[model samples]
Target: MFNKKYTIVKNEEVIPGHRLMCLNAPEIASRAAPGQFLHLRCGDGQDPILRRPLSIHFADRGRVYILYRIAGRGTSRLALMARGDIVDVMGPLGRGFTLPAPGERVAVVGGGIGAAPLFFLLKKIGKIYGKKKDMVRVFLGASTLAMVPGAAQIRKMGFPLDIAADDGSGDFKGTVVDMFRKEAKNLALDRVYACGPPPMIRALAGAVGPDPAVEVSVEERMGCGVGACLSCACKVRAGEGEGFGYARVCTDGPVFDLRKLVL
Candidate 1:
């Protein structure tokens, strides 16, 4: 993990309320993995002393991109930042998702802003496994079509996509869990991965059952980005007899095996 200052290379809105910001951080980007995230200080040590954590949407040779929605003061301030601004960024911190092994179909489930981090995963993993037919499938859930990720762009890259919306606004009408339950049989999904709100993650864990091959990304409010402060603790299931314990979402994970998570 590295704590470095990076200049904002560009910031563009991919959709309303959500913007994709890229930073010039070669060291952090070079080692960044999908499902990993960075903690950024908003507006030169203003109120909200804690830095905000954002997942890596995509990382290139010398840049790392983060996709985030403007939800509050911190994010609103972030939205105000110009392209040339510099910010304090620390990452690629925390444990991340385990990539699917070769010859196995990896199914990715994303909801709302949860789709952000999966973009990196899809870009990196798809290039490696997409050559094998039916190797990658993405299921994105949203309130409507406008809220989902770039489905057309994702399909253009040679990955099959499935979309689910609560209001029947786009393709499939229902939650991602419902869509997964319906299409799982025909898709031959070998392993499942997901990142989203707490309720969705809990439901996904139940749906995935005792399967050891499933992985999930968990998000929680954070204080110190590193492990020391114990500010971002999440409850996760331990082994057979260990019951449940608190794991730091900022360090021990942002990712965990489905079977081992307490939900």
Candidate 2:
């Protein structure tokens, strides 16, 4: 991981209360992988001392993008940043998703802002699998149409897209996982990757029950972005003799096997 100052290239509101910020950080961007996140200091001030963790939305060329919602003071301050501003960042941190084997059909799933990392994941998969792109599917879910971030961008990529909104505002009138369950049999997917709220991830884990092929990106409140703080601990199942154990999301994962998660 590297700690550096990056110049903001673009900062715009993609949806009400949601913003996308792109930074010119070639070193971090080039090395970043899907599911990994960046720890941003928000501003140079000491008021919000802790860095906020944001998923690496999409990385291309020499730029890295972060998708975030304005939920609190830290984020609200981040939103005020304009183009050409500089921000302190530490990243390409944490483990990322494991790519499926060639020829294995996979489904990429995301809910709300959790969909951020999956975009980079899809882009990498496309580069690696090339013509096997048809083997991949995309599923997105949000509470309402206006809440679905990056929908237009994902659609423009031309992957088979399936969307769900809890209030029936989009293509499907239900939770994303509900739609996934209904259509999973037809997709015949060999693997599934997902990220979202804890409840959603929990439901997905139950849906996939014991399936080793299901991977999830988990989120937790964090202090230090590195492992030193032990602040972002996640409960995980342990081996035979052990009951359970804690894994630091900052280092051990933000990505883990769905079946292994204790959520």
Candidate 3:
């Protein structure tokens, strides 16, 4: 991990309340992998002392992008930042998703803002697979059409995109998981990756049921963004015992096997 001040190359609103910010940070960007995230300081002063962790939306040669929604003071302040503004950040922290092997059929499922990290995963998969033969499927879900960000860009990539809006504002009128269930039999999926709210993850875990191929990126409130704080702890089923054990999301995961997670 690296701690550096990155210049905001681009900062714009992607949707109604969401913003996508690109930062110039070659070191971090180069090392970043899909499902990893960055911890941003929002401001220089101590106003918002703790850094906010955001998933790495996409990373290129010398830049990293973060997609976030303005939900609180830290994000609201971050939204005010203009192009060329600098922000303190530390990352490409946490374990990321494992890419599927060649000829392996995989499915990526994301919900709402949770879709952010999956973009990087899709890009990496595209580069590795290098075919337009429907080897990968992308599923996105949101409460409404307005809440689904990056739909056009994802669609343009030609990955057999499936979308769902709870209010029937999108192509599929149900939860993203619902869409997945409806299409599961036809896809012949070998592996599955997902990220979203707790409820959605829980439902998905149950649906998949002990399938070790299912990997999920979890969302949790973090403090230090490192192992020291123990601020982002998640429970998982114990190996020998019946109870659960704690794992730090910042270090041990943020990405975990759906069957092992206590969801």
Candidate 4:
């Protein structure tokens, strides 16, 4: 919930469609948890209108990293930002993933750009549950191997990784959901955390059906990263209501219990 102005120390392209930006924001990093995001304002003035929300990829002692894809004009402008640039940032916002407890077997599933949050999640999970390290498993999926961070690095962190791609280009040539199903079929899991495109998340929901431990990250276009504008409403499974209801993806959650959400 912190509103901190950060100066960009480094902004570099890490992959073909994505850029990694490091910011000097000690406060946000200090309080940030895995799966959280930041709302970044492009310019000093309001010309761009709304702030773009970027996933918090990694954070260290006095800095935070955001990984984003150049999907539109706003993100394109953000990619062009130079080093030493100052941007208005609000967050470490939204609810983050629940850290695993002792001996809790956890599974992390991510797809496409969704791998952003899972990076931090992996680090945090390892930090908290390292004593029971053997209980955790991570699966990442993308169109190709280049889209995800190196698997060796993630495995070095002590979590076993299962990778999949769409075109038979990698280990499992199918959707990330396929990886989830394959892993779930082979292992005993206590909880599952997922982030990806809508179709991926929806498919994951089906794959994780009736599992109370499955949590998902919701991605949607937003006019306001904050909930005040109600511009990022998404259809969600209404608990007691007749059918689906609109929920604010920004505030209510970017992370939700998979069984509770209609997706």
TM-score of each: 0.95, 0.96, 0.96, 0.94
lDDT of 1 by residue, 1-263 (tens): 89988999988888889998999999998999999999998878658677999999889999999999999988888898979999899999988888877788778999889988888888878767858736777889998888886677778878888899999986799998778767776666678889989888877876664433787888888988889888889887767776888999998889887777776
Q: How many backbone clashes does candidate 3 have?
A: 0
lDDT of 4: 0.83
Q: How are the candidates ranked when ordered by lDDT, highest leading?
A: 3, 2, 1, 4
Q: Judge candidate 3 against the unseen true structure and give its global Cα lDDT, from 0 to 1.
A: 0.89
lDDT of 2 by residue, 94-136 (tens): 9999987878888888999989899888888787777767788
Instruction: Please give the RMSD to the true structure for each candidate, in Å.
Output: 1.5, 1.4, 1.3, 1.7
What's model 4's lDDT at 191?
A: 88
Q: Give candidate 3's TM-score.
A: 0.96
lDDT head-to-head 1 vs 2, winner: 2
Instruction: Name the runs in model 1 displaced over 4 angstroms.
Output: 209-212, 239-242
lDDT per residue (tens digit) for residues 182-247 in model 4? 778766677888899989987887786454398888987776677888888878777686588888
The candidate that wins on lDDT is 3
Clashing pairs in 1: 237-262
RMSD of 1: 1.5
Worst 10 residues of 4 by lDDT: 203-212
Candidate 2 vs candidate 3: the lDDT winner is 3
Supply candidate 1's per-residue lDDT for 169.
Answer: 84
- Return the TM-score for candidate 2, rounded to 2 decimals: 0.96
Model 1: how far residue 104 lies from native, Å: 0.5
Taken over the whole model, the C-alpha lDDT of each candidate is 0.85, 0.88, 0.89, 0.83
lDDT for predicted candidate 2 compared with the true structure: 0.88
Which window of 10 residues has the lowest lDDT sum in candidate 1?
203-212
